[model samples]
Target: MPQAAPMLRVENLAVTRGGLPVLEGLGFTLEAGQALVLRGPNGIGKTTLLRTLAGLQPALAGTISMPPETMAYAAHADGLKSTLTVTENLSFWAAVYGTGAIDAALDRMNLRQLADRPAHSLSAGQKRRLGLARLLVTGRPVWVLDEPTVSLDAASVALFAGAVRAHLAQGGAALMATHIDLGLSEATVLDLAPFKARPPELGGIAGSFDEAFA
Candidate 1:
């Protein structure tokens, strides 16, 4: 049988922050049933790259090749509605994504007990779990997460890791920027330090850097 294409592919991609290049010449492919952990020092452009991939921002150049609606992004923000209960928040997401029940998501993220509590009433860690649960309700094949374990206890970390493991086992792909070790034995680490963007070469004809690149 022929080899299947990657679930996500980025080739020669360049992205900017504040109108200046941050990550450039980035090329990687993520296949189904696999996980990729992005590793780099703080301020080395991991978040910017992820945001670019998540469609939160436009890439300065290059291509992101993937099937439409295959990606779901969860950022540092929990993205919860303070007035909405945990279950309600998840149900809203499910309806938006046109996915199924939130019960499994609740159990996986250990949010079942707090399902009836308003998001504003939850502690920091609880809020984060609820945010991560949004990923499950998405029902998308690829997960794009940034600092997914910001506020969590050891047990909660384990829950998050288990959720990721199960997601991969089901032929899903995840690309995440996280410092906490998920203990995913199958994950590949991609260090962005090498891919950090260098200032655009001065050609002596520039009005502005962005203009030169443009």
Candidate 2:
């Protein structure tokens, strides 16, 4: 089989919040057909890293190489417009990416029936599903997801895992920061806890936490 191309590459990345370093000297690469999970405790900068990768936050240092339109980001906030219906939200994203069909994406995320319902009227998990449905309408090869499984029930989580597996199988890549265990044995987990910086030195916590989450 032919090899897939690299989807995202981060080199010597460092980020700061409130002028305090959060990630230091971090680097990683994600290729098409693979998945990398960002794992860490709360307040450890996992979300920040995802935001940086998504281009929603600026990196204090280093380079993030990837095409913006070729990337799909599902943030922790659900990224929904309260006044819009679920269908409207998905359709809006579909228009943004200019690829795939909105209805199909909603079907994939199991939100077809809730299409006309206002975003704020849905439950937390339903809103999350709607957020993920946005990605399905995009042809992006790189996925940056933060807490992708926030409020999913057992079946919904399983559905999401299946979608992720399908994406990987199709030569797409995903960078996700999630608390839920994905059960993807082949996934590479990058723990960010130790990478949280101290007050003075912009360095990470002592020791190697890279392999802990793997």
Model 2, 1-214: lDDT tens per residue? 2565567889888876544567777888998888999988887788788877878767777898875667888877878999999988888888877764787778788998899999989999999888888878887878889889988999999888888988888788899998889888778999887666665533453323243321
Clashing pairs in model 1, backbone N/Cα/C closer than 3 A: none
List the RMSD of every prediction in angstroms: 2.9, 6.1
* Alpha-carbon local distance difference test for all models: 0.88, 0.81
**What is the alpha-carbon lDDT of model 2 when measured against the actual structure?**
0.81
Off by over 4 Å in 2: 198-214
Q: Which residue runs of candidate 1 sit more than 4 Å off their true CA positions? A: 202-214
What lDDT does candidate 2 reach at residue 93?
80
Q: How far is candidate 1 from the true structure (C-alpha RMSD, Å)?
A: 2.9
Candidate 2, position 27, lDDT: 85
Candidate 1 C-alpha lDDT tens digits along 1-214: 1258999999999887766777778899999988999999998888889999989878878899999999999988878999999899999999999996899999999888999999999999999999999999999999999999888888888889899999988889999998878888889999888888775563211123555433
Local error of candidate 1 at residue 30 (angstroms): 0.1
lDDT, residue 158, candidate 2: 88
